[model samples]
Target chain A: MNGSVLSARTLRNLLPALSLLVLLAAIFYLQPRAISYVGFNLMLNLAIPIAFATIAQMCVITVNDLDLSIGTYVGFVACIGATLLSGGIGALPFIKDLQASGALPATLPWIMNTPLAGVLVLLMGIGVYALLGALIHLRNLPSIVVTLGMSFVWLGLSVLVLPVPGGQAPGWIKSLMTLKTPFIPFPIIAAVVIAVAAHILIMKTSYGAVLRGAGGNPKAIERAGWSLLKVKMAMFALAGFFGMLAGLSLVGLTTSGDANIALRYTLLSIAGVILGGGEFVGGRISPIGAVIGAATLTLAGSFLSFMRIPPDWQIGAQGAILIIVLALRTLIDRAEKRR
Target chain B: MNAEPGFIRRLVAKPWLWAYVAAAAVWLVTILFTGGRGGGEVLTAAFTFATFSVIVGIGQLYVVTLGPGNVDLSIPATITLAGAVATKVMDTQDGLILVGLIVALACGVAVGCFNYALIIILRIPPIIATLSSSFLIQSTAIAYGRGIRIKPPAALADFTTAQVLGMPVLALCVIALAAVMEIVLRRTVYGRWVTAIGQNMRAARLAGVNVGRTRFTAYVMSAVFAGLCGYLLSGFSGGSSLSMGEEYLLTSIALVVIGGSSVAGGYSNVPGLWGAALFLFLVVTMLNTYGFGAGLRYLSTGLIIIAVIVAASARKATR
Candidate 1:
């Protein structure tokens, strides 16, 4: 009985990777050229940003909170990186007016033109997220409602920064994202590094255990003399940090962003987390699994295109895939119970 | 906490009252900017637009009142699909209006059933299930309609757009519907069971509340309301468009929260839905009146919502 239960758990853990491989196999079988390294790079490149977003979402789920604002937050960050850090793409109209009126410096300072400024802005965003966590905790407010409202704030900020969709990413960031990695694709390396690093940080560290504990049993953590507030703030801050990374990576690849650029990421990240076997409650999460799940979701879109399905039906197919995956999990759970 | 204040104080203490207060304040601000110019027209427009939001908000409130993690995220897709199917069925014939409405409701019923199956049979979380189902439903709408924008029947359109003494007739009828729903919520056994389940599911189950059936009913009712709103909205707007239901996704959830319903569940505020819906519309109008840019408008809208939530929560805490 114990062995059977262990095997079931192992199967559950491997399901994300298995599904990813299945998708890849399907793509390869349909389009033989996709087996090449160049084709793999093309297919998986977008998965890098999605993986980062998935990790960010995993951080929030680790604390048993949902972030409806993450997509907009990422778009906001991308807008900041592209407009301000990239040295005023086309010079924002309002900023130009302000400068002409001597209300601002004629030229942006050297610091404002650098990646460091973008980093500072992203850190400030993290602070805001931490503050949100504090507010949610102190006020006993639902995270969903708070985050839903915050989504508009982020979107507004994005529009204020970029106004229009066109902007240039900083050259260095673009180069780094498109770096010619030897043999394997750059995206694959980055994804692996992200997955391993996050797995180590969250699944192996002592404080990570405490963070998960905060969600799994807040009263127990409190009894153990841990500050639930601090744990929550840390989780939210981590989410913000990863979300910013996602934005940076996305802008690096696309070289531009708009207010609505990453809106779909909100749903995609949630789906990735669930696809990777993370539960909504109980603080059960897997960093590597989430990364794999993100890759799978990205690949699923590619698989549909390869299948020559209509663009209209592709989104519905993705939804059907999600339902089918979850349904499969249900069957496995039932089988385990029957044992 | 023990001492009872005057009747006015008690009325003020009701959570739903603050939504009305906020709506009035926002309306006052907007009219003040115009020096009362076109204030009546603005209110009339607010009534017309807010009716759709209120219909959806009521459904969302019931679902939210079903406890934590229970929300119907498929509403927007259901609305879009219903509008598309209804318009296609009506085919601009006044005689087939009833058939179109029925077809719309049938779409809702099917969607609601599919959503519940994912939730109960597959044991998927309601949030994920509704979200994924919405994607499927939206795709179906896109495929079936192919972005077609067919006009509604003349009679249906006229009914939706009709006015009486500067007030929307549709709005008045909806208000009547809301009143009936409020009574059902407060006085009916089913309503109490929903509240009980939200308050404590296990306890309610032990007390023989038929939790599954009640939950099924709530989800179905929510989808049905979305369908009705879609049928009406497409007529009011002249035709159904794919993006028509997009804004309602957030508006439905936001109105419920702003209306002073407990997000944690076990509470329902029917009157507050109208107040919140009206407030939301007026806030947008107020921003537009001030000639604020879209960015600033969105920013202030977000800030105002956060402020309201904070204030409402503070009031609840004090009580």
Candidate 2:
């Protein structure tokens, strides 16, 4: 009985990865050349940023919160990389767009040339996210409401900074995205590294347990002398850090910046978390599962097209998968309880 | 008898009062900026525009009042889909408006049913489920419309443009609906059941309320309302496109939340819904007159939503 129970736990943990492999195999069999290295590189190229964003979202969920602004926040961070850090503070034709009177002085080219400005603005955004955490905790504001509001602000700010989609990524980021390895593509390597890193930090550590416990039972954790507020701030900051990584990597990959680009990441990352077996109000999350989950969705997004179904039906099909998987999860839990 | 303080406390407690204040502020700005000349005309136009939002806002309020984190993200997409369904049903034929309306409602019910399945049977979170359904409806809408261009019927357009007593006829119809809903919410067992379920779901369930069904019907009603708006907007704007109903998602939420309906559920103010909707319309118009671009408009609207909702949050926290 002990051995069977252990195996059951192990199977539950590895389910997401196994499903992803099966999906990959099916794609390869359906399109033989899809097994090649170049094919995977092309297919999973965008998955890296998506994985990072999913991790960011997972961090927020670790504390039983949601960041509806994740997509727009990443877009804002990309604007910072593509504009402010790339050049002056107000450099993106803001003046040209202003037809009436007052304009911001454009005499700060020297200050804008350095990378520090980008770093500072990114820090400022993280700080804002931390403030949101504080406000949510103190005021009992719903994270969804706050983050939804923040999404508009971030998207609007992105447009204000850039005003258009044209911008240049810094030298380091461009090179980082293009880094080639012997047998594996850089994105695959990066995804593995991110997954391992997040797994170690979130799943295999004492602090991580404490962090997740705060989500599960905050009052009990507080009784045990843990400051829920600090944990909340740390999770949000971690989300901010990964969101910045997602934005930078996206800019490097696309080699351009558009405010509207990466808008899909919000819902995409949410689905990734759900696919990975995360829950809405619990600290129940898996980093490796999330990474695999992102990859699975990236491939599954095209499966309907493979079946000769209209591309329009693909989105509905995704919703169906989500509902089915969730139902399956519910069934699995019920069976476990019965056992 | 120091009832003055009691009255003051009561006034402060009404979440809907703030919405009226915000609307008044917007009206004051319009008067100041537009030199009081186009006040009647601008208000007439704003009223017409807000009438479209009210239809969506009422349904949104029901779903929102279902408690914390319960939102219907599928409404905008439903509107888009319903618009296409409306036009397709009409097929430029005369005297088929009722048939078109019925078809549009059927489309909404379909989407709402899907949302119900995801939330009830599957145990999916309401937000993510609705969001997923949103994308599904959006993609299907795109396919159905075949690149987002469908001309609305002329008869419907004529009705929407028709005015009664210096106000759009549609506005009066919506006000009548709100009045009816007000009565239902105040004097009916169904309304009490909804509020009780929203206030305390587990407790209500233990008390023998059908929590799932109540919430399900709310989603259904919201979709049907959005369907009505979509068909109307297709006529008002001369056509339906991929993004025709997109803006309503955020704006509808803004109206509902600002009107003092608690995001945490168990509270609603229907009159404030109309006020907040009109206020938002005027805000967009006033900003346009002030030469503020889309960025500023987005920024301000976002700030107001956060401000009003956060205040509600803060007040609830204190309680």
Candidate 3:
């Protein structure tokens, strides 16, 4: 392996990240103004939520599981946070705007401003995710079917919490989203931090070895005196935790909550995970790749809007990119194996 | 396991039994609560919707039978795209209905081929491949339907309700289609090839089963059936909308799983899909008739599905 020439093994690792840079360069070429600090934030502000959601999805994928309801569950957590941030249930929602504190009487006053309630709900959501893990493992059910059913449940719950999409996030979260500095955009900083933190936990740590082993070959890991159930539960709990963060960040960005606002995240996250050099049934995954993958997709979502392409074909353009990238990866793998 | 169902034969060996039990319970509960008033109409409505689900379920059943770790999340998007394309092609012309329907089926075949290329050629995971395709399909659907207001052709409406012997003709047609599928799945050479491949891919390949081709056909069939369902749905829905086919995605999978099809592949209870679809629709109708809240309906639907999965798995694990 010459210093200047990248070997095939390293090329496969670098391909996904390099692809992201190429996309950015192309954006600069076509729309220089879109690469500006203000432009980047505005375009990628929504992407932070997706990035976190992708990480959430990646957690499950690392364990050879898929979370079909990532978006819905995140939305559920966000709605809960939104409802609590509303301060209090002022009155019955049906009677008036529900913002009207004077509409109804004799109702048990519920405090919506309590961060403690938010914590409890977060725990509850995590519990649900863990339960899904148990169900999939103990029940021998398919993760796709279980999560698909759970999505409807989470969607229904989110709707019940916020009949209409209107709520303010916690003050700190709102500030976090708004923080500005004289240097690079906050989204870049946030994306880097998330990617690095996840990489360390998933790729560098000793326990991370166990987690990967659990997915890569469960029987071997079990033979080494590790409980598959515990590892899987941890993976799912991490996924749920990250899902909540995605939802909270989304609410922070939008300053509102709609049960269905994050619906697109479901597919986006799955796509992001795969695009990031992650496998479906293997323990193979890359945290840094997942972040870049999310960013790539987030930008792809707006490619048409930025290029003045018809909004109608915007979706098709994305599919084409995904197909091309995947095909490229396959070709690379074949070439690498042949040598 | 099918070789000898000596013990636990009643449960895992036959998923149809579970569907039958569920269907019976749902009907019994519906009649008990509705007091028999409008029972016939209710049954008709439930079965009609169930027919739509059954068509989609049949496609999904085929795909899921491909093997473990394989699924097609793109069906919802395909269905939506089909509706959009077919309706736009018809452009309110009753005579062009056949043309529109054919085009819809072709799109599905195209999508299926694309999925196969992604999974087989590119070696991408089925979940990601289908999902990406879905995104593409959905965007195309959105663009195609952006400004066009759909008016489901008059002939389609008539086709949906054209009755024979006082029974909804669409329902009977769906039954016949299911029968045809059952034959193709159980009696055909292709069917046996798929089953052998699913049971053990390497062994099937060793036996010269043309595993790739069989798997490819299964996915293509899935997309085509889903496309047909979408075209019919647009007619029943009176037009296409952005989210018209979203609900069918999960429900179709649920129907097949509950019908006793193995999510891991190799085995499927074809008619059990019909029972699962019927039971699911009946449960929703029963809940509605009882004035259950929307939240309760969704919650109960989820819980029941979970319960079924749990029960089925319990039997599976014991074996």
Best by lDDT: 1
Model 2 lDDT tens row, B1-319: 5999999999987878887787878888978986888888887887899998889998888888788878898888999999987887787665888998889889988888988887877677788889878877887887898764656678888888889767998889999998887676667877777888889989989999888788889899889999988888887787777788877887788788788887778888788888898888888888998998777887787787788777887777677
Best by TM-score: 1
Q: lDDT, candidate 1, residue A223?
A: 99
Model 3: per-residue Cα lDDT over B118-213, one tens digit each: 887887777777877888888888888887777888999788766665567888889899999889888999988887877888999999999888
Positional deviation of residue A196's Cα in model 3 after best superposition, in angstroms: 1.0
Total colliding residue pairs, candidate 1: 0
Q: How many pairs of residues collide in each model?
A: 0, 0, 0
Writing each residue's lDDT as its tens digit, candidate 3 over A1-339 gives 353234766877887798788888878888899898997887778778889999999999888888888988888877866666444443224434543556455444456334666678778899889878877876657888788788878887877677778776777888998789568989988999999999999899999999988889999999999988889888999999899999989888887778888987888888788778888877999889889888888787566676788867765776777787888888878876666
What tens-digit string does per-residue lDDT give for candidate 1 at B89-187?
999999999999999999989998988889998897799999899989999988888858899999999999999999999999999988988887889
Q: Taking the tens digit of each residue's C-alpha lDDT, what string does model 2 give over A18-83?
A: 768877777877787876678777788888889999999999998999888899889888888887
Candidate 2 global CA lDDT score = 0.82
Which candidate do you rate higher for TM-score, 1 or 3? 1
Worst 10 residues of 3 chain B by lDDT: B3-12
TM-score of candidate 3 against the unseen true structure: 0.94
* Root-mean-square deviation per candidate: 2.3, 2.8, 3.3
What residue pairs clash in candidate 3, if any at all?
Answer: none
